[model samples]
Target: MTTICVDVMGADKEPAVLLEGVAQALAADTDLEVLVAGAAEFVEPFAASHDRARALVTTEVITMSEHPAQAVRAKKDASIVRAAAAVRAGEADGLFSAGSTGAVLTAATFGVGRLKGIKRPALSLPFPGISGRPTVFLDMGANADVRPDVIVQFAQMGRAYARAVLGVAEPRVGLLCNGSEETKGSEMALAYHEALAAADCGFAGNAEGTDILAGTFDVIVADGFTGNVALKSIEGTGKFVLKRLKAAMGASLKNKIGMALLAGSLKSLAGELSGDEYGGAVLLGLRAPVLKGHGATSARAVCQGTLAAVRVVRAGLTEKIADACELSA
Candidate 1:
């Protein structure tokens, strides 16, 4: 069974919203277990009712206003902190949260700790591609600036992830750049281009932003700044298009019937652009798996995120990454 620690206080909808997702996950998978961290009053009752769920009994929670590192250090009893501690202590297999991104990163880095030789933690998000397989992108927002070694590490870690979780053998890796040419992109992108070329991991040439969802590559390596910007841009455009599409579909009864007839197609298309279908973002280079659902994530997304963590753990992602990457530890 895959036991995961869940931070239930800081989500957009808080304890109630989180419980529903936990319940959904419990109902869906008999092999999955969740230990919810929150006030005793909230978590205890919920855990009592569910067969696979347990209560961590935390009293404090880190909010968005508090600084990430400071709050983690001071709020020892915070939900996120306690959850991470649980994973580190071997009480849980991994960590999952919809709290502040900064808090999640800080907790994972300090509480669960990093793998050997890894100075930074990275956020790797799955981007749905045309091939029905997702292309993973790294350093979504962990570090705005990273060295060449970090970028190289991202590719190595990503390869392990694709193999373990995505079931891809010899995943194709790419460096995100303005152009497909080797001459384009910043010095860092160019540096990794040369580094990956010599590495054993399958390195595809530089890929443009348009190639991200085109199924051009299985892994895209980038600095946090560029990767975050590209991610938000893609999400924003997807939302805009969906909003307009909905408006057009609801314009008239005729369109409604037409859409109803094509509901399956539309739903499939929407799934491709949805955050829920993607199962949130995974924090890489840590001792254990850590997944962060979006702040405004729905109950389904929350459930999917929990399931994603379980999948990663069962796949032995952490072990695979440590073994594949040459670490000092």
Candidate 2:
């Protein structure tokens, strides 16, 4: 059986909501078990009700505003910290949390540990594609600054994720930059371009912001700073477009008739665009797979995130990543 340690605290939503997600996950997978960590009021009842779930009964809660490393050090019984410990101790194969991103990353990196030879772990997510399959993007917010060599490793990691999770054979990799030209980037981007070109990993040259969702590249790598900015920009733009569309659809009776005709297709598109469908971001290059859901994630998102973690553990994602890194090295 694949067991995942779930941190049920530190999210914007109530603990009950996350618990409901956990219940949903349990109902979905018979081979899955969960070690839920949270306050006694929340976790005790959950564990008592679900035969597959066990409560860790954490006393402390880490808030989003606290310093990640420091809070992790001080709050030994914090939900996220204990959840990571469970993974490290072999009590769980992976971890899932809708907590502070920084706290989850810090705890998982330091507690669960990085894979051997991995210089830094990356935060990656598979983004829904426009015309083709979802593209795997990495360094979402792990390392704000990285060397050219690290960027190359990101390419290898991204490629491995594309194959293992997204089921892409021979995924093409790209470095995010201002322009598509090899000559069109900052010194770091140029260095990355040169390094990736020489690396064994699939290198498809530079990708612009417009190419992120254009189905032009299977994997895109960037430093955390740039990747985070680009991710937020895409999210914001999507929301903006969605709001405008809603307004336009409700503007006139003629538009309402048109909307009724396209309602089914629109709902399908919304599901694809919603981050919930993909679960959450996975921290690659770790000893075990660790996923972080959005702070305001819904119960469906949590359930999906738990299932995603299960898939990662069952696929032996960490072992595949280690082999990928070793081969590249």
Candidate 3:
């Protein structure tokens, strides 16, 4: 059984909704075990109602709205800290927290430590691809300001993630930039591109923003600033398109019929694009598994995030990341 620790107080929704998600995950995977850190009174009842209150999961209950560092420090019994401690102690294979990205990162940093030669850790997000392949985007916000060398490390990290999550043997990697031209984007990007090209790790040259949704490569690397902008742009475009579709469908009966015919397919497609459906972002190049859930995550997202963490541990991503980082270094 893979033990996964989750910060139950992390999401915008409180223990109620998040705990409900824990229930959902438990229902989906009977072999899995979850250790929730949050209010025990809130979580215990939910566990008891399902009769899983006992052996399937244990509760640690940390409060919401606590300062990231202070909460982790002062709340010796805080859920998030306990979860991190669990990972450090080898009691859990991975940790998931939707509460605060900074807190989660800080806790994981202190709890798990960094991989050899990796100066900064990255957040890796998998985007749905064309032809059903998954594309990975790295440094999504783990480090806002990064050096050229760090971007190269991000590429290697992205490559390892694609291999582990997408099962691509030798994933093609591309640098995210304004244009495909060698001179486009930042000076740092140009230098990093040249570095990756020289290193020989399946680098696929540069990729423009337009190429991301088209899924041209298995991995796309960028500094946190560029990557976060690209991620938000894609997410915003998706939401905007859906809004327009809804408006169009409501305007007339013909459009309504059209939407009715396409609703199921559209839902499946949207699900594929949703961050929630992907579970959460993985903090790469760390000694232990650290999954960061979206702040707006619901119970389903928490449950799925825990599952994703399990897959990360099972993939032996920590070892893969260390190997990749050593090569990149």
Candidate 4:
């Protein structure tokens, strides 16, 4: 059975949302189980109600503003720390949290420990793609400053993710750049291309930002700064388009009738673009699977994120990444 430890506190929504997520997860997968870390009184009742969920009972909660490293060490019983510890101690197969991203990253790296040959672990997000699967985009907001070697690492991990989650046997890896030309990006891009081309994975050469959602490649690699900006832009644009569509559909009775005629298709398209459907990003290259849920996590989003983590754990991503990292190194 695959067990995932989830931090049930410090999300944009209440801890109760995580419980809703747990109930959804139990209903979705028959072979999955969850361990929740948070205040016992508040969380235990929910755990008792669910056959697959168990509460760890933690008192300390780490807020976004707290120092990640210090809070981790000082508050041994903090939800995030204890969640990571569960993975480290073999009590769970993975960890999930919608808490402070920095603290979660710190806990996964320091508490659970980095996999062998991993210099820096990356936050890999699945961006909506035209081909009905999300393109694995790495360094979503982890490590603003990166090296060529780091890009190489991202490429390997991203390919593994696409293969595992998306059922792509051999994913095409692209280095995100300003233009499609090999010489278009900065020195880092040039260096990355050179290194990635020789690596074991399928290197698709330079890809422009436009190619991200166009299904040009299954895996897209970028520096954290660039990747984060692109991710936010994609998210904002998706929201903007959805809002405009809603307004246009409700503009008049005639338009509303037309929308009603195409409502099924529109709903499908909306689901394709919804971030909640995709759940959240995975922090790659760690010793165990770690999923970072959206801060404004809904019940559906939590369910999606937990399921994604289960996919990663069943994929044996941690062991596969360790083997691939050594080869790339």
Q: Pick the lDDT winner.
A: 2
Candidate 2, superposed: residue stretches over 4 Å from native: 256-271, 327-329
Rank order (by TM-score, best first): 2, 1, 4, 3
The C-alpha RMSD of each candidate to the native structure, in angstroms, is: 2.0, 2.0, 3.1, 2.4
What's the lDDT for all of these models?
0.86, 0.90, 0.77, 0.84
Deviation from truth (RMSD, Å), model 3: 3.1
- For 223-262, candidate 1 gives per-residue lDDT tens digits of 8999889888888888787677678788999877877787
Per-residue lDDT of candidate 3, residues 20-123 (tens digit):
77788778877777766666676666656764333223344343465677766665665666677778887777888887776787778877767768889888
How well does candidate 3 score on lDDT at residue 162? Answer: 83
Pairs that clash in candidate 4: none
Indicate the worst ten consecutive residues by lDDT in candidate 2.
267-276
Where in model 3 is the C-alpha error above 4 Å? 46-77, 327-329
Best by TM-score: 2
Q: In candidate 3, which residue pairs clash?
A: 10-99, 37-79, 38-61, 38-62, 39-61
The TM-score of predicted model 3 comes to 0.88
Candidate 2, residues 1-329: lDDT per residue as tens digits?
Answer: 99999999999999999999999999999999999999999999999999899999999999989999899999999999999988999999999999999999999999899888899899998888787678888899899999989998899999988888888889999999999988999988998999999998899999998878877899999999899999888888877877787788889999878878887877666555555678899999989999999887789889999999999888878877887888432
What lDDT tens digits, residue by residue, belong to model 4 across residues 304-323? Answer: 88888898899888877876
Error of 1 at 141 (Å): 1.1
- Residue 57 of model 2, lDDT score: 93
How many clashes in candidate 2? Answer: 0
